[model samples]
Target: MIAKLQIQLNTALYLRDPQSTDLGQKIVQEGIYMIDEIGFESFTFKKLSKRINSTEASIYRYFENKHRLLVYLIAWYWNYVEYKITFETHNISNAEEKLKIAIQLITSKLADDDNFPGISESVLQRIVISESDKTYLTKNVDQINREGLFKGYKSLCMTIASYMLEINPAFKFSRSLTSTCLEAAHQQIFFAEHLPRLTDIKKEEKMYDRNCEFLTSLIFSSLKS
Candidate 1:
């Protein structure tokens, strides 16, 4: 097997770097599996320790709290998505086409990435769709934002928003539309799956395609002069 990928994260997210040691790496690898299997709300250091055959204190040495660990995972995901978008769009010249491709990439079903062996991007995508909001919905979000824990997500939005501006210089809501499209892409799919009444997408249709279509329509419509 290929060596596991290591993407350096913000130091503030952890008390110790989890990528540096075997147990630390296991903390991250199993953390992703456990979080995906259960969820951030249901996940706990005590439970994680039991699953990993480690102590809660050991987990604490890597992360101060479960919330911080969730943020770390989400941030890693945002960075990975941004990298994929940038890589895919680097050679594409048309701004409108680029945005469409970006939307498709953002909304489409995620595949497991080989570059990052320990974490499953598909599961991470589901987590982002389902639980990413919890990362910043807390009272301490302002403090964490100041610490740059959310920079990866913000950077992704900013980059995509820039694409909108290039397509329509007169459009004033590029950033707003960018963020809305990104969030709505996942949220609408979530709604379609469990709360079908909340979405216009029918249950019978290919859900990912419809979500992508909706976002593509929304973004282009908002950008057209």
Candidate 2:
């Protein structure tokens, strides 16, 4: 039912929208897999070009560099999550319930959404969990922020923070709490899978459920305090 939703993004993110044409779409579809297979530091456009059977010049036509492409994918993910939050919680009246649902969506393991035909959200979520910080951790983050490249992330945080205020208007750290929960969900999941000693949660088939419970408790308890 949510297939037709359009995710508007910052124009500065790409030289051309990768969703616009077949070659562009192939670049994105394969790029996600390539990035997931190889770490982002090793993910060069040359490798991507070889994988997609497209020339580097052609790939560069859609993106100024691989960093921009990474940002584009990150932005797409943020917008997609925001779309899901709005869709799933629209009918619920209770603020606490809405926030709870939002927590589940953000913290749980992602599955491929049939609505987005070519994109694998399950794989994309791993990118977001592992590589999202790279998008803004650079020295040029200030310049890129001014270009509105991070608006998707900022908007998603704002949406969640609004729910926080609904439950507790006096909570002064809604934005901080929202951003922390978002990062924590990803960090805890990563730690569970790769570095077990760093997190209390055990790695298992349902590890994400433990991560969700941890964040939900952290958020609600902090709000109640």
Candidate 3:
């Protein structure tokens, strides 16, 4: 998670408009697309400049370096996710519906064709696995943590727990279960890589839909006394 944290930290640096110019916004948008395509290791200012029809100097004028550009991209992704989730699921009234809608929204978003393809499993493992040892390299660790990804995750869990509670206030909503749900949402995308033995279900979009359906059923059924 260290590398992931570092990337998140770096991405945060570009959250604002440095010059309020059209070029700056374009740089941010195109940079995200490029990073999603090529990834942080292979992505460079020159490549981004070429992709966006801008000069390397122009990119530098907004971002200090490639790492900073990446930080911005990560931030943008999270911010977009937060907005999407809030807007899509906020209208549901019941806890069960809220939890179900939240999970559906999360799964749907991850399944989106436009999500950053540059973030491969190897890269994610490198970030999470190496987090402790490489913490110092990421200057924006505190800031990224403060950005509320984790908090947002916890809130989702609380929402789920609230729904579960509605069924039976005694139901134990352990941290493990919350983490399981969160990981399950992510696993829906990379299940082929993460759980190869679990059947190549993700290759079929129908399977994802079925899985979501089954997941909600299981959660609701399990909550019943």
Query: Which lDDT tens digits does candidate 3 get at residues 1-225?
Result: 123121222333654454256787677656656655665668798998998888989888888777655545444443444455566667766776666775575445353223333333333332222221232257776765675424444555665566567657777753455556555654544554466577444556465565566567657666673
Once fitted onto the true fold, the runs of candidate 2 whose alpha carbons sit more than 4 angstroms away are 1-5
Which ranges in model 3 have alpha carbons more than 4 Å from their true place?
1-12, 18-20, 64-68, 109-143, 146-176, 193-195, 198-200, 214-225
Writing each residue's lDDT as its tens digit, candidate 2 over 50-76 gives 999889999999999999999999999
Best by lDDT: 2
Per-residue error for 25 in candidate 3, Å, reads 2.2
**What's the TM for model 3?**
0.61
**Number of clashing pairs, model 1?**
0
lDDT of 1 at 134: 92
After superposition on all C-alphas, the RMSD of every candidate to the true structure, in Å, is: 1.6, 1.4, 8.4
The CA root-mean-square deviation of candidate 2, after full C-alpha superposition on the true structure, stands at 1.4
lDDT of candidate 1 over 1-225, digit per residue (tens): 777666767888889998778898889888888988998879999999999999999999999999998999999988888888988999999988888888989888899988787788888888888888899899988999999999888899999998998988888988888888878978898898789889998765488999888988888888875
Residues forming the 10-long window of minimal summed lDDT in candidate 3:
1-10
List the candidate 1 regions with Cα displacement exceeding 4 Å: 1-4
TM-scores of all predicted structures = 0.94, 0.96, 0.61
